[model samples]
Target: MTSTLFRALLAVLVVGLLVGQSDAWRRRRRRRRCPNPTDALSGAQTAWDATFMFECPGAQVIRRIRSAHCNTVEDRVWRFECGTVPGVSRFDEAFWSAWLNEYNGVMNFQCPFNAIVTGFRSEHRGNDRKWKLKCSKVNGMTTFNHAQSNYANEFDLPGDYTVPSGYYLRGMHSFHDGRRGDRRYQYQICLIDLP
Candidate 1:
């Protein structure tokens, strides 16, 4: 009986160890993205993980969403405002303008200089509701910090940003080696727009 118990315990230990190792491996794999095949082999990691959604009165809609995971301390969620457009909050064009417009944000793992993600959504049309979320190293600064957002917008804005209702809910991910100095920093930046 003693010998049998010892064997069962050993098996349990082995399985637990395997499970832990596999979890770590999966996280490592998630930290990688399709950046040029050669570049990936050279040592590439996800700079940031982010998304954007469209907001409206009826229901919260998801616009555009993308994630770039990396070797970080823990998972997080976030939200931000990407500015707004005039005379077209009800239409999709406003959302697209927020995307195509340049000089909006920065690309760094830790934003020491104070950068922000503005997730703008049309709220009651006249309200022109927009919220701004600043990226920080503390923890849980935005909405899309996790796999999903409770305040996700109405729906993804349709493509073709040239027409009257043409709009694009834009989302971007920026990554950097948080493990630079004495302490290695590994994190992702996420953003979700409102309706």
Candidate 2:
């Protein structure tokens, strides 16, 4: 009886270990299947003043692009990307907003309701740049709504910027701010809840 009990106990232990390993393998497999952010392409390029970089948040992919030329010296361009998260399906329909301006300080634009900015239209007026954003909705995600600039002064200069993990790039704004023809850039990042 003692020997039989020991064998049964060992069998139970082996089964438990197998189950745990199976669960771990599934989790790893799912992670491997999850997508990675693609290469950052020129969302917008111009002969205006400066060059800057914008990238999608973790595991997100580029989905669209928008560009406009307000004048010879005031043209702007934007690239957009989207990806699947734990509670979100594919980005469905996309919409555009009317031109918006934020004067000399900041031109902050957030997608209304549960939408995210996928593309944009920018107009450089006298001393301000007005923006019209292309917004899109993620099918299953609603835990995030608003996007805000990561820097107070729109990062002041042009360079590379990436959205942190659990967040995505919603919009990008750049304008000729100083007298040296330098450009100031603003990146709007939106945070999402991950499982």
C-alpha RMSD for every candidate: 18.3, 21.8
On a 0 to 1 TM-score scale, where does candidate 1 land against the true structure? 0.20
Q: List the residue pairs that clash in candidate 2.
A: 61-82, 62-81, 63-81
Query: What total of clashing residue pairs does each candidate reach?
Result: 42, 3
Q: Please give, for residues 73-138, the per-residue lDDT of candidate 2 as tens digits.
A: 333333444555545444565667766555454555666656665554555445345567766666
What is the C-alpha lDDT profile of model 1 across 46-108, one tens digit per residue? 212232343333212223332222223222122221333332233322222232211222322
lDDT of 1: 0.29
Model 2's alpha-carbon lDDT is 0.51
TM-score of candidate 2 versus the correct structure, residues matched by position: 0.46
Top candidate (lDDT): 2
All candidates' TM-scores?
A: 0.20, 0.46
